[model samples]
Target: MTKKTRYGVKFYSVCTTDDYGLNLQIYSGKSDEAEGLSKIQTLVHSLMEPFLDSGHNVFMDNFYNSVDLSGKLLKRKMHTTGTLRQNHKKNPTAITQAKLKKGQHLSKRSKNVYISNWKDKLEVLAVYH
Candidate 1:
C-alpha cells in the first residue's frame, strides 16, 4: 500500500492469479482490533482463509512482510513474496550483515524461507518461501 497521504478511503484486498478480486477488508484505522497477532498479519491470514492449503502465492509490500509471518504462511501451503523493511526483526544474520555494492546482493535461506538484500540506489530486501 502507498504511504503517501491521500484524502480517501483505504481497503486491503486479496486477488486471484488472474487479478480477480477474491475478498476485501475495509481499513477502519487501528482501533479495537484483536489481541494476538498483529493487525496486518491477522488481516492477511483472514483474507487468505479460503485459499489456504491450495498452494497460492501472496505478494505484498514491506508493510506486510516479515520472517515469522512468511514461515507461518509456508506451513499453510502458501508462498509469500514481498519487500522487507531493512530493520525488520528476525532477519538472517549473514544476509543482513553482508556489505553489498551498488550492483550486488546477498541471499540466504532458512528452511523454506529465502531472504535477499540487493543494493541499487538504495538497499532493498525481499523475502519469499
Candidate 2:
C-alpha cells in the first residue's frame, strides 16, 4: 500500500478503482521475497488476473507505469494508461528531452497506444493514452 511520488520510486501494492474511487485490494506489497521490477510485474499480474480478457482499462500514476508493464497488461486483454517517467525503458528520447515552450505539446502513437508530452512549469509531463 505504498504511495507514488513525482520522483518515480515505487514500493507498494496495486489497487483497483472505479467511478466511486478505489474499489478493491488487488495485491499487497507486504512480501520481502521479491524485489525490483519483478515485484512490480508480480503485483500487476495478481491485481489484473480477475479481470483478464475482460477488456478493462487500468489507470495508474508514474510509479506503476512502464512500457513493459503496459505491454504485458495488453496481452492479457487489459489496457493501461498512466503517467510515464521520462527515463522509463522504451520511452521515446525525443519526447522526454524535448524543450517545449509553455503551452507546447508533443504526441506520438503506435497501434493502440499514444504518448503525449507537454511542458508544465519547469518539468515535462509524459502521459500514456
Candidate 3:
C-alpha cells in the first residue's frame, strides 16, 4: 500500500473500438515456442491468426516488437510499425549503437527492413522492417 506499484496477472488481448475483445490470450507462465518464432512472436501470431493475410497494419510498442517478427509478419501480408526493444538481440547494432544528439535521428535499411533510431530523452528505435 505504501508503494505505487501494483502487480497482477497479465493478459494479451486484441480489441477494437466497437468490441472490448475480439480475441484474448492469458499469459500462463511458459508457453510452447512455435517453429521459427519466439514465445512473444508466437503469442502475437496466435492472437492475430484470424486476421492474417488480409493486409492489416499492426502498431505495437517495444514490448511486442522485434526485427524478426516484423519480417515474418510482412510475409503474411501484415505490416508492422513499432518501437524496438533496445536490448533485443535481433536489432541491428549498427543502427541502434549509433550515437545521436537530442532531436537527431539515424536510419538504415537492409533488404525490405528499415530501422530508424531517434534521440530524445533517450534513444528510441522504430522499425518498419
Q: Choose the strongest candidate by TM-score.
A: 3
Clashing pairs in 2: none
Give the runs in model 2 whose Cα sits over 4 Å from its true position.
1-37, 122-124, 127-129
Candidate 1 C-alpha lDDT tens digits along 1-129: 979887888888898678899999887777554555677778888889998999989998999889878998999999999998877678887887788899998898988899999999988899998
Ranking of all candidate structures by their lDDT, best first: 3, 1, 2
Give stretches of model 1 more than 4 Å off.
1-8, 29-36
Taken over the whole model, the C-alpha lDDT of each candidate is 0.86, 0.68, 0.87
Weakest 10 consecutive residues of candidate 1 by summed lDDT:
31-40
What's the TM for model 1? 0.81
Would you list the rank order by TM-score, best first?
3, 1, 2
- Per-residue lDDT for 96 in model 1? 78
Best by lDDT: 3
Cα distance off (Å), candidate 1, residue 25: 0.6
Clashing pairs in 3: none
| C-alpha RMSD values across all candidates | 4.9, 7.1, 3.5
**RMSD in Å for candidate 3, one decimal?**
3.5
